[model samples]
Target: MATVPFPFSPVSCAFSRQTGIRRSPLVLALLSSSALLFPVQVHAQQANAGAEATELTEIVVEGATDSASGPDKSIVAGRTLAGSKTDTAVEDISASVSVITQAEMERRGTQNLDEVLAYTSSVSADEYGSDDRYDWVRIRGFYQTSTGSYLDGLPMRISGFTGSRVEPYGLQRVEVLKGSTSTLFGLNAPGGLINSISKRPQAVKHGEVYTTLGDEHVEFGTDFGGPIDDQGIWSYRITSKWQDGNNGADHTEDDRFYIAPALTWAPTDATSLTLLPSYNKRDGNTAHGIPYGSGIDPKTYLGEPEFEAMDTIEKNIGYAFSHDFGNGLQFRQNARYTDLDLTYESVYGATADPSVSRSAWAVYGNSRRFVIDNQLQYDVSFGRFDSRSLAGMDFSYNDTDEHRVFGSASGINIYNPVYCGLSCLTLPAGYDWNQQETARGFYLQEELTFDDRWILTLGGRFDSVTTESAFPDSGLSYKADDEAFTKRIGLTYKVTDGLSVYGNYSESFQPISADRTSLVGTPKPQEGTQYEVGLKYRPANYDALFTLALFDLTQTNVPYNISTTTQSQIGETNVKGVELEGKFALTDQFNLTVAYSYWDAEIVEDGITGNQGNKPQLIPQQMASIWADYTLPGEGIFGDLTLGLGVRYTGASFADNENTLKIKPHTLVDAAVNYQIRDNVALAVNATNLFDTEYLSYVSIYDNTAFYGDGRAVRATLKYTW
Candidate 1:
């Protein structure tokens, strides 16, 4: 019944209020477009040369430079921004980072974020099986769906089921930073975070259009970008896609429409500003799995088609600004505002019996979030010692409102389900609540390099978080406030010209919502710590990179459900793992990737549940994958042809915390083939789960539900680029 103060103090309250005033979805749309009209004047430098000789000479030079946020033209990326928020070389950072470029995504024919990360080390994509609602991903044995997602180095905060969904086609690359990251980015899971770089306008002209056809599926998309003026003062890019299909499941639809427009104004090489706006809509059905050991078809639809629906609409607008003072100082700012609306309804089997009793549920929700980060970086050199210092402050506010309902549905036979309309269901009024959360953080980082051989990094962050919830129907309210400081330190040594070894220690802090009523007063925030050591190698003679990592991670104050209404935070978990990843461009015509991970996760302490020392549910001990692609040259009768193949293996895991039900291991295969008909046209075919292997991707004993992995799916695509 007591109210808590907001995280922003009086000094910062006015700033927060100004941000809250621009919550209107319609107003944001207009503002996103109007941003281009007001352009500040910038001075361009002129160069003059004098020749003393009788004969004068003229020279012309052309080249392109790579940035942390730019497109990666190759599959093997040597530098990344996600590791340190700067354009830092991968080998110099004292952490494990994996990058998946557009080239790799195209070669594998990835359709979703899950498929894009399917072959990455220390990552488990599609952990919840065939679900159209979200991209369920787990990193280092911890779920990251709610906390560890980012775009353009900014957090994509999600409350409940309201979250932003990304289009893989619009991304230039995906970077995965493994281990605790609160020292750089506040409020995150210990397993690390995934940062996706958006496709931006290019100085050169390029465009591509493609169409894909498959069984019960069809899609069309295009991406084009170029300079808007001859002097290259302005550039623009537009990416759009439409798809209609199903995920090899009966009575389910997977349809989406996505478009993103980007514009950049760079009057000078040192100063640049870019605007990124996007809209996405998805209409599909909820994922309802069959009962465990029910002997029913995996593709069978348990819910009534007439009453099942899951749909979402999301809009986002953001900008990135940077200016270099040319005095060993630089400033950067990034901000984004996101709005999401979701509607979900389903009737699923309630028991594992032959006569399935069904339960109906529906959720209607809306979420809005605004986040901003400002950074100042300075570089100074003193003799043999060089230093790069970064200082930043970030703030985020999230507001969510939801209405939930529950009812009973008529029973159905497992073998043959008789269709029934919504009239046969009994419904009642449900609870409605509104929740708001705010977080503010100030961080500082220092990177020191001595003689260009040894690198040392130190970072610290202080965060203030607050959460408030109110139940309009019950006239009850709950509030919680938390503050914490996280820190990180690392050191890297260049062993040779092409090899390096590094070690790091980092920490994380996450504030939980107040919806989970705590029996022992307010719930404490979750804290995580990790220690990691890794080795990286990049051959100077070839395009290849290899990495090996070992980490020990622990999370404390984990919450567990004590009852239907109450929870307790007397649990702790520890995960130790080893990962190996390699990317190789062995020759001009061959590319290969290999990844392997082994995780040993255990519940170290749980006073209430009495399940201590047991393995956590749904976390595998080992996962390995390999993918290879080759192109063959022919002078006659055969054009340029490419072939690709991949194999993935997921190890066994437990279904419940008690370790009673063991889920068996499974292996899957993926293949692709492409032929270049001409210089500007090509055709390709891709297949996933080539053998149609049937295995359980997830099992919930408490809910009496089990989901099957995706089946064999094949699609053919024709593309033209100019």
Candidate 2:
């Protein structure tokens, strides 16, 4: 789940201690690693210990779904919801799931998948204006980049830590399913999983445009979508966006153009299909800023122009379909094809020099990926039990070839005179990492309801993966095949009106592969488990929902090459946490939403001796966020004005398991004001980090060093509808 280096400009702040730990880092890593294998989960019977003595509710919230039976808009009716229910007892398969609404995305002006998931439990996404459009996000103590992502329950393309990439626009919601999910999905990382729901056909006609202006030649452009037919059988949406700006730091300029077009067709009452096509051409100079070891002050952090960051020219085409057979069954399918041409360069120098960081040879790579997912579901009744059953399969192939070249150290340049561009041309552009991988998988799941009161869900999956990387040293290639099976089981009970409780147990697996120059033995398939329980309450006659959940997760058989350094989870990991999220519409003009999380993660094994109780890098123990908005109900223009506020906080963390380095905790506040110019237009201004607060969080690690997140940023937008 680790992300490759991208175009992030660190503030001039430097903080970390090279001081050695009194105990062995390996020992501590191992002890902590064991935590990944053994976790204490919360179950229905234990609910009273975590909170009050609670029972189950009668109804649950239902989100939008396509089926042969068509679609229905039914809100929650005082029952346990899908996101947070804890009743039937197992482990963590009943884990909590959080959804980021489309409304929230616009308020934050999020440009990609990475930016959109930032405000969730167990999620830490850092996008401090690095060169690449892609983002680096952490969940449950593991790095989840392009590799650890999904679109509508299907995997996307992901390679190792080389070239950088980004997600496109036109998404309805980003759903975060915490903990192991291989039970229904297949071949996954243990940290957690992400499911991106694309924008679909709607009966209503809707579309919008947005424009923005900021500092350092900053600018923005956007266009939205709605309905395209009278029968409401067809729908279309388009997004056109462009950005040109200099980051808050030096040598950082974000420039790009993007186009996304999506369509949905409902030829019959029982069939629906959607097609999405996207293209993006991003050209910018790469950025390599100060490493955390130098202790550079983020305030003084302007970057050198020498390192070539991420230069990628890409295209994406995808299709999804849903069919309702009318026998209480539905089918779904998703497919995506991608093409990528990218080049990257790096400058490695002593931490002290602001200018000569490029000392070694430059690195570059090129790749392409194709993936397809198909699924079928059936809903039926058996005497006292009603069920929704699913069967699915997945397949993916990646063909990537790298080009690397050597360059002289004296060629390093820190300014606009031009280093190599982000993505290509560092050395001679022919150097090779030389690797390829292929994988295939299948899975099944079922949700059962008994006497309209007891609900049970069960699922399982299997995956086959093969990897090959060649080493030029001995003309030898190391290869490995990883095959695994995972399962999920949970129960939910509706014991009373307006309340429901649930609990679940889930498992996951990750395959292994080797590169030619690889010395890491093909590891056993990584294994993961999750246990969770929670309560959901929705009062009748009120427009509000509340949920509280507790979860414990662990992963073992992780990938590691003792010959080099142990990455995020080389051995085992244990993550336990509690989360609370709610939304309240107090009145016709006032609304509020709050999300809070507490996480405790530790490494259980490192093959070394003695490092335990150490917090995982980038995985803060405590995190919280809240937002509110209110509109004045008046007779004139004053009634059109709305005000909003948001805040997020994180606890302190150690940069590494050895605790040789440390990062301070921080909080951010944002304020917003909006006025409706008329019925279809509005102007909004937002001030983030209004106090100009300055701080840094962990990004990634190499050997014994750490990197930080971005500093303060502010943006405003003008929107119009037709």
| lDDT digits (tens) for residues 1-722 of candidate 1 | 00112111111111000000112333233233222221110011011124232221111001123456657656788789999988898889999999998888888999989999999999988866865567677888777777788999998867755655678988988999999999999988899999998888888888889999999999999998889999999999999999999878888888989999999999999999999999988888777687788888878777878778788898999999999999789999999998989887888764545354588877788989999999999999999999999999999999999887777788777668676888767778988978888999999999999998899999999999998989899999988888999999999999997899999999998876666555555667789999999999998866788899999999887666555566677668888988988887655566778888888888887655566777777778888787878777644455678899988877778766777777877888999998878766789999999999999976655566788898999999999887
lDDT of 2 by residue, 1-722 (tens): 22223322210010011111123333234334323322221132244466753221111112233221112112111221122211122112246666665555655556556557756666766623242335555566555554567765556645643444454345656667676767666666666667666565555655677787656545455555556767768877776778786546666666667777878898888888888777776655443344555555543323335553556666778887778888887777778887777655544432444344444344455667778877777778989988777787878887676655555343332222244444322345344556677888777777788887777888778888888777554477777777888888888777665577888888877654453234344457768888888876665645566667888888776543344454323567688777776655444455466666667777666544334455555566766666666665434434267787877666666665666556677777777777767666678886666676766555345522233445556666787776
Whole-model lDDT values for every prediction: 0.80, 0.58
Clashing pairs in 1: none
lDDT of 1: 0.80
Candidate 2's TM-score: 0.81
Query: Could you tell me which 10 consecutive residues in candidate 2 have the lowest summed lDDT?
Result: 11-20
Name the 10 consecutive residues with the lowest summed lDDT in model 1: 12-21
**Highest-scoring model, TM-score:** 1
Model 1 collision count: 0
Task: Compute each candidate's TM-score over C-alphas.
Answer: 0.90, 0.81
Give me the runs in candidate 1 sitting further than 4 Å from their true place: 1-65, 350-356, 515-517, 561-567
